[model samples]
Target: MPLLVTDYSWTQTDSTVYINVPLKGAKVGKVDILSTDEYVKVHFPPYLFEAFLFEPVDDDKSTAKVGNGVVLISLPKRTNKEWDHLMISTNDKEKKKVIRQQALLKYQDKLTSESRSKAEKKHAEKKYALETMMKLEKEERDTIQKMKDTEREKTTAELAAWQLNQKQKAEVETRVKLQRQRSRQTQIKAVTEEQENQCSGEGNVCKSEANCKKKQVVLPAPRLTGNIQVTFTPRVFPTALRESRVQEEEEWLKKQAEARHAVNADTEELKDLKEEHRNPDWLKDKGDKYFATGDYLSAVNAYNLAVRLNRKIPALYSNRAACHLKLGNFHKAIEDSSQALDLLTPPVAANAAARARASVRRGSAFCQLQLYAEGLQDYHAALKIEPHNIALQADIEKIRDIIQGTTADPDTQ
Candidate 1:
């Protein structure tokens, strides 16, 4: 039998020996095995100062080495407990089934990993396509908007020119009319004065043909007769069309603002949902933030959803209980603290500390329900176990003060 030289232990229940050994470090740095029905040989590389097993049964294979001074020891698999656990009894009692199971599990894991990778690739492709398409769409929209702006600018210039021309034409027509009126007035005044002068020469105006003829002196030149023409100017140019275009542009701007705001809000909502749904801690943080903000109802909702995914938490239940207390739900506070006490198993020191906290919190809840005696007992028990706990000491002092006043009889007063 091989000498058990390593740190290993064996327990004999009846005649069979059960051995538990750690195969780690350089011992497992290399492994090779070959087996027949009666025996198995395990080879190990050197730098392996000591190889551990429950105990190797064959003495001859001990210290056997390859050319590089590595041990090639063989042991009977029947004697190894872990190996035995891995073994299955049948007409062909062998550990082949465990190997097969492990292989199948590994293959399934690989398949699942491959499937996830494919899904991720597909999503990446889709996202890339969506981004590209969005870029193109934005470019197209910008181009169209530019064209519209250009058209609007061109129309505005045309309207301005038309208005300017109309004003100039109006001014010219006014000037011409003024000149004609002045000339006519001047001619009438001259004729009237001349007639008056001629009439005054005889102390009265003569109506006789010979007197009229004497008064009507011959003009130096005969007045030319000409046809007078008139032109009408339009009051406005591109009148109704330009006004309608401007109104349309204003409407389009309003529509664009509304659309952009809606899209931005939707994108923000989507981003929040994605980040929250993927990680549970994010939701918990949000709940804590809400609680900090004094929005107890919103905090309750957020914490409740986070707890649904993972219930193995002490802080979640404790904080939720705090929220319940603030909301005046004493029964809910008791229930949550109770659940927290049941679920949490912290490290020894942490567990002890948490025990005192839970006990004190429950005691407060009990006191709110007027279970004063039980509440006081729980507080005393916590203080006794953790004597130096300052917070507990404070609570105990407050309770003592309350009791000192309450215990005084009315008759004493």
Candidate 2:
């Protein structure tokens, strides 16, 4: 977030940063815009290159600025967790191209059944999208039309409720106006009554007892009395405009949802196209050969390219995870292992054994970060799958001993 030297208003509670970017909303995809006191990094998916640039302008406030704070950076997405392998992917574009070309050549002749299947699926999708677009032309598919009846019902209910609120508010205002008018009229009437009482009741001075004094005569003072009615012209309620706005907002939401469906359809089509190019099984043997030759970086690359080609095999992820661990990229190692674990099956069997192996490797990395508790959890989980594995058994005992020794007794502390 940027500083507000003058004044600023923030309505959202979610963590947000104020960017004075020249473009308003060009940011996209799943990414975090992280900033420290001295620097900022925009992490992006592996395939996308940065396209946006920010420049600050001197506004009416006239704050003088310093030299160029320009930063040019490219964020890369790690598709199958290849982050920690040191120089795994060459920084030099030409070298990277060579390595990538070599990697492709290493497996170019062997397209698996899965690879062909993905390509077929992608072609079908493209065909379908084109055919649909041609047919629709300007007439987009109303995917939200299926929800028309429901949406109509919901909108109707909202409109009705809003109308009722308007009517109620009108009634309240009308009643208040009438009541106030009545009160004013009543006050006038009361004043008149008091004056009339003062004038007509015991308010006279006897001149004399009619000179011969058998009867007394009184002279009356002026008395005022009358009916009073207060009336006011009708005022605009402002409710009709408000109700119209509410209905408009609901309609806008419906339109936005429809737009989302259209975008989602296109997104899925593009996803299929990308998947066709990333079938993992196609490069499995090639990656395995690299693994065998102790070329961990190449093995990681082969696995990555294979994963991009196909993702149905958990074993490939696990194998790539092993290479990542060897290269000190624990984040990537953990990610691949976690994914493999999710795909692994047959709980407590061979599948669990594979998953347990991954767990141990990830746990070892966790221990390196001094995350003993998380490390212990992974180790314990792994033990559940392979209770009698000699290596894991020793790891657990050592960790337990370390934890106990390092944790001081509460009384002593």
Q: After superposition, how far is residue 224 of candidate 2 from its true place, in Å?
A: 87
lDDT of 1 at 277: 62
- Give residue 216's lDDT in candidate 2 (0 to 100): 23
Best by TM-score: 2
- lDDT (10s digit) by residue, model 1, range 133-153: 999999988976786788889
- Model 1's C-alpha root-mean-square deviation from the true structure amounts to 23.0
Give residue 30's lDDT in candidate 1 (0 to 100): 43
Candidate no. 2 TM-score: 0.34
Q: How far out, in Å, is residue 375 in model 1?
A: 2.1
Candidate 1 Cα misplacement greater than 4 A, ranges: 1-275, 384-386, 400-413
Per-residue alpha-carbon lDDT of candidate 2 for residues 275-311, written as tens digits (9 for 90 to 100): 4344555578878889899999998887876775467
How accurate locally is residue 90 in candidate 1, as Cα lDDT from 0 to 100? 40
* Error at 358, model 2, angstroms: 1.4
TM-score of each: 0.30, 0.34
